[model samples]
Target: MEYEKLVRGDVELWKRKLMKRSSLLNRTAKKAQTKMNGLIPEKANSVITESIKKMVQGALFGSEYLTKTKAVRAATLEELDKEVKEKLNFYKKAAAVEGAGTGGAGILLGLADFPLLLSIKMKYLFEVAALYGYDTKQYEERLFILYVFQLAFSSDQTRMETMDKIDHWETYKEDAEEIDWRVFQQEYRDYLDLVKLLQLVPGIGAIVGAYANYNLMDQLGETALNAYRLRWFNERENGQKQEKQSGL
Candidate 1:
């Protein structure tokens, strides 16, 4: 009887120890995850994207100041043009660097839609972050992100509803294949915004951004082929008051 009692006591003690250990482990994991998340560029990304969304929305709705300040408006328009041009150059160079054939360049030429694509990229990034439990100011950003994520994860039958009628998921898949995960990791580490948010979690933000960038281009052509991407881009900018009211 004594032996049985002693055995029972031992079992109880073991159970207590296990409970304590489990509690400690959970605490440690939570702390680590928080620390890691702190390293992501989420804050800066959020701030910059929110600002961009606001600007775009204002331009769309015809803000009084924007209309009144001809110089500011002109500068803003010039900036937009410059951005489109820069993105065009980047796409051309990126395609060249990636060794995309004449066919790829042709597609890009047909799709020369940076105004649309930029707006989409900005809004999509904001939205995807929201879906992943990130916060976004512009509701449109949220919608854009959903579109991209849906496209990214979708099976063929469902995609046609949101994006352009072009069938480029397979092409996106190909471009995604060319990503150097190692280089991406390094670049992710180097990204200042991510460095701040995901300080402990290292490469998560980079992986997300790289994958998004590569895949965004997968379905759309470079500026040479598809200028219609502008509609998608400018749509996000069309709702400034809505963007502000929605926290964007």
Candidate 2:
């Protein structure tokens, strides 16, 4: 009963967060992202678009496949989250270090931060999924991780849309649109633009990079935890319904 109460409280907090509206800063950041993208040469933009699409796909299908699945076990939500928090912290620190290293360097080295940060995020998600007792090696679960990514980094409109799909995922998963990687990359870039753009500057780049990467990882961790929590609660509800119907 206590365990259920704790999970319920967490879900409530997550609800408030998801329903919260975007701020002026968020709107401005998104606009800035769009403008920055516009500044890129069309040919270069196309090249990047393709590159991001392939990079994301590779992350989705790659490491998780080679990883051993966690043995299925029964544990309370708190126990699960305890482990989850540890992993989140571990990844957060790692991302911060990576960000600081790249950001402190000149422009040429700072450019490398993108793929490195992406790998950290994807690898962390896979670990989180495994901790939550999900099998990332499965195609659908890996796809679910992408939705979680969308939920974390997308603009408000896109985030809500992605949230709905994740909320009803068991049913909605089958029909979820083939993620438009073009849009995916756009929103993601826009979301990161404000902080990441600053990371290109000379003196302050390191500070911005470390702070930004730390927060980004934190955001992703929250999204992943709540998403899996939603799944856990829904499964519990389904189990209860079945039990009552069976007069257990």
Candidate 3:
């Protein structure tokens, strides 16, 4: 129970951090990213957006064959957290290696890293869902994975909006059809644009690629862990309320 209390405290702190307004530096950077996004040709933007849309849809529909991890049941939160952390480390290493290999090769290979890295991230989320005792086979659960992805990579404003949806997922799920793929693609591409661009440079590409990929995975791991914790505590509180109502 002590561990549960500590975990709950961590989740509360994380939620507060998530909802906080962006700092001046972040706001400035976001403005610059917006300007850069606006400068891109419409045709280029359309192609990129369509590609990401198809890639993500493919991931969601084809994930059943990709994810081998079974849903974990009958485990304490502590046990689940331990396994999740271990799996996070494993994925980080894999991403780093992929980044390095692609980055070190040449510009063509570096360009190829985008879809490969996306696949790795999606697979990692699928496994994390199973570890948290959620079945990705369910359509809603796959949508939840997309929300987690958006939460981790979106701008500060979008992050808060996504967090609100995640916080009230049970109610939100009732009417949720699908996410806006254009918004999803734009936000994700903007978030990684600078670092991934640096990963194309000849000399420093290898180092930048490895460091960027590792840190990206680390960020996703932290976000995914806290997102699941929110759901875990929500379910527990709801169960308590139901039990009290029944006793009455």
lDDT score, residue 223, model 1? 20
The TM-score that candidate 2 achieves is 0.90
Q: Output the better candidate (1/3) by lDDT.
A: 3
Backbone clash pairs for candidate 2 read none
Ranking by TM-score: 3, 2, 1
Q: What tens digits encode model 2's per-residue C-alpha lDDT throughout 31-120?
A: 777787889998898888899998887776665764453735347787888888898999899999999999999798788899889988
lDDT of 3 by residue, 99-210 (tens): 9989888899999898888888899899899988899988899999999999999888899989998989888999998898878998898889889999999998999999
lDDT of each: 0.35, 0.84, 0.90
Candidate 2 lDDT for residue 93: 100
* Candidate 3 backbone collisions, by pair: none
lDDT of 1 by residue, 1-248 (tens): 46435534543453243233235654464456446656758766466455545544543333222222121211232333444445444543443323222213433422332233344434333322322232344344333333443333222223333344222332333333322222222222222232223312333433333333454444332221122233322333456656888994
Better of 1 and 2 by lDDT: 2
Ranking by lDDT: 3, 2, 1
Which runs of model 3 end up more than 4 angstroms from their true locations?
A: 39-44
Enumerate clash totals for all models, in the order shown: 28, 0, 0
